[model samples]
Target: MRGPVSEGDWRGVVRDVRVTGHRVTKRATHGRDKLLREVAWLKALPPKAVGYFPRVLEVRTGEGWAEYDMDFCPWPDMSRVLVDGTLTVDEAISGTRSLLGFAFDVLYADHHRPAPEDFFHVSYVDKFWRRASAGRGMSERFDRLCSAEQLDIHGRVYPSAASLMRELQRDTVLLARLRPPCLGRFHGDFKYDNVLFEPATGRFLLLDPRGSTVTGDSDSDYMEDLAKLRTCTRGLYDLVRAGAARVSEGEGRISWEWASWAGPALQRFSALDAWLVDELSVKARARRDADWRVRLDVLMPLLLLANAPFQLAPVNPRTEDIALVLHATGVRLLAEALELHGTRDLGVSP
Candidate 1:
């Protein structure tokens, strides 16, 4: 039997034993009350969803524990595939493209005009802003980093987080002009481990859709998977390793270890993303293409910013410093991306 695996929000206790002769059981639990909500949503999925997720065999709820049993998926976990070094660039690109394409097709198959609330559900932005601005040390470091007039952020210079934030907000406004006519259904959580791929069938099984429903905010769901995918695949593990090192060294200052490890991965991810966006633009039209590009530009930074805290908060004390550095990195990336095209788009330079 596999021991418990803990991520940010939930701990999954997996049992290798079968419910009958062939069915394995997994008991997923959360320290908070969220597990039951996820269970409820999993149980309520329409039959069509079974093709993209595991089949739920049973469910139970109690005071401090929530659990569910599902057929053990035989497909390979995508994260393991990546970690094992067997994941090719083509495979990574295909897997994400196929899975996201399928989700969009299913969710938008019968779409009409987007719900009115979709246009205004910018809560994701606000949520990330709150988290990114919350850590004093990280903010202080970010302030220090930005104080350098020569601080090169991907070839652009940001004088301060304030200037960066202003540029990001400005880009947000520009990208807002090219929204899709209607909001469609999307996977709220599409991390790699949450996705299972069957090589033989060229199909993907998506797990753990956000169990909660948001009225009129479906637009936020768009490309949410891509944002998370880029984060996890590109930098999360490096940040984790960096944090572990910082803890071991007992220093919170920025170190070469982070850049040494995460730098290449981040670069690779950027190239991959550019390739994907280009491929998608050719397949979709100009408007849809622009929306996806904008999502990569604006929405991804927000997602990364919001996730920085969640990633850092649950670790032991030693790792807190690492988390702070990681958080600062996310903010730095956000600022850099916001200023990528410079202020020419806004008719001014900062």
Candidate 2:
């Protein structure tokens, strides 16, 4: 099969060219219209933010399937950088600094003024429940796991998943309380693996981005991006994806056992939570934003919970039952975060 050749461009279609190299085709096989939004966002990127993202070479669509072809970076993504056991700690830190620069300068650049967006509604309630009730009982496993009295995952105690969900659901004021600093030009799905490093060009490029159709009414909110980054640092998204977590039921409770994350890149990534808080604090103080930590704390677990359903129905390969473990972990984390911070941030205390 021959790929669509552009004027004066060298290209050929290799059958089943799913692996990334020079150019890659992203197909929304589930009729989700993800490619449409991705193409839209790629086009919407500021002209100045050129090198931060790949160039869109082609877009093709059909009934129940949409796809687009774009340049693929040669470097490993941040997720791989953290756990693939190749890059050293120093190398990971330096590369991560560059990744942040590229991401903030372009992919998550604040292009619009602040708006009182109901960030909670978008980040937590909408993303999570949308899947739980999205026709299939995709998230029911999470519900089952959470129904336990308590969760002990990797030696950490957490509230029951159902309990956390009920508390978060009951907090009506918090749902309408989140007002983000800016609401323009967000990457949609700004997670670790989606970011790539191009060595020869010293560029940190972004891959998958959530289309507007996938999220809220518009493409904005860097908080989601921050939450995703935190998902790696704190939520341990890459670690979980790497099959480091195990799930089990015992003595009337669900528990998780984890392998030690001794990879070279993880030592550095694991310590970044404090640094993230300090960095966000400095920025929030500069912005005169009060209770930024509270907001982030609230946002983090929501992002985790929102991400749970997708894990249950992952497109990439995953360890068997990792999705349930991920959901259980999110529930635990949410229970922990809300318990520590309390519901004052939500404008009501329980």
Candidate 3:
């Protein structure tokens, strides 16, 4: 009997069946037709190359949903592995790289463009940055939630709704202008939750491609995006620097005690810094294809300032790091804005 299976975003019903004397499971989601389409697409691809995806058995359109049967291999997701502390960093990275590489190869090589009807395939990175920068509606929603309860920030009251709204709007504009290149196909929602890993064999299984999409944007927009990403990423690096400085100041310079406690904290900070730099550099290559300098000078700092608050929330040695980075980056961005648009003090109202 088929019953509801509570997974992530997709709605599905799973049932038990015997296939060739082997007891297997069948999962169906008629509400989501795209799953069937993607499954078909994957099946059409060379089996050896697309072995990561589930082996399809049958796809039949029924009353309410499409019935999809595959060889049900019960595997644990990355989150489970993380909770159990079983997955090594190397294993995780390799697994992630495989999925990302596959997506990129398929889209770029095959020219598997996004269909006109497929809006759901829109990339998550694009969506996140766009929504983050386009602040009015979201800010209002955030404000309404804050007003219903007392919000606190670093022993201080949260900023007024209007202030939050203004900040969000400013951030949104800066991020939208940063136009990072969409290289072929993207996983859309590339996060730990959607990935499964077998720690023993170092195998990673990527499930649910509901968010995958084809890249469709101009070269200029893509370049601008990369430039903006660099600025935002650099801002993150600067924040780490500021956090380290604060930690040093708070706990005197060069002490064994400080070194022991702060070592792990420092490693995390370095990890964040390294990730940002590598990501920025990887994305920056696309910028070489267009007029990046002009757009970079204009958008980089703004993107940095806009993203500061969100990046600085976690209470690590780098707690104050985001604020410091924002201040420094904001200075450059504000100066440029003034230079271009003239000194117009849009001071905080209310």
Worst 10 residues of 2 by lDDT: 5-14
lDDT of 2 at 34: 45
What clash count goes with each model? 1, 0, 8
Q: What is the lDDT of every predicted structure here?
A: 0.51, 0.61, 0.40
Rank order by TM-score, top first?
Answer: 2, 1, 3
Higher TM-score: candidate 1 or 3? 1
What TM-score do all the candidates reach, one by one? 0.69, 0.80, 0.46
The residue-by-residue lDDT of candidate 3 on 207-314, one tens digit each, is: 554323223221123323333334423333332432333321111111112224334444433453355445434544533424234344544554444444443333
| TM-score, cand. 1 | 0.69
Model 2 vs. true fold: TM: 0.80
Tens digit of lDDT per residue, candidate 2, span 221-259? 566677677877778788778887666765434666666
lDDT of 2 at 229: 79
Query: Which candidate tops lDDT?
Result: 2
Superior by lDDT: candidate 1 or candidate 2: 2
| Model 1: per-residue Cα lDDT over 1-350, one tens digit each | 11132232422222222455456554444433444555555665656665777677777666655566777677787766654445566777778778757755664343454534434234453444444455334333443443334333333333344454555555545445324455555556667777888655668887766553222233344555566666665445433533323422212224434335445445545565666666556544633544565555555555554554454334455445545444445555565555563343422224
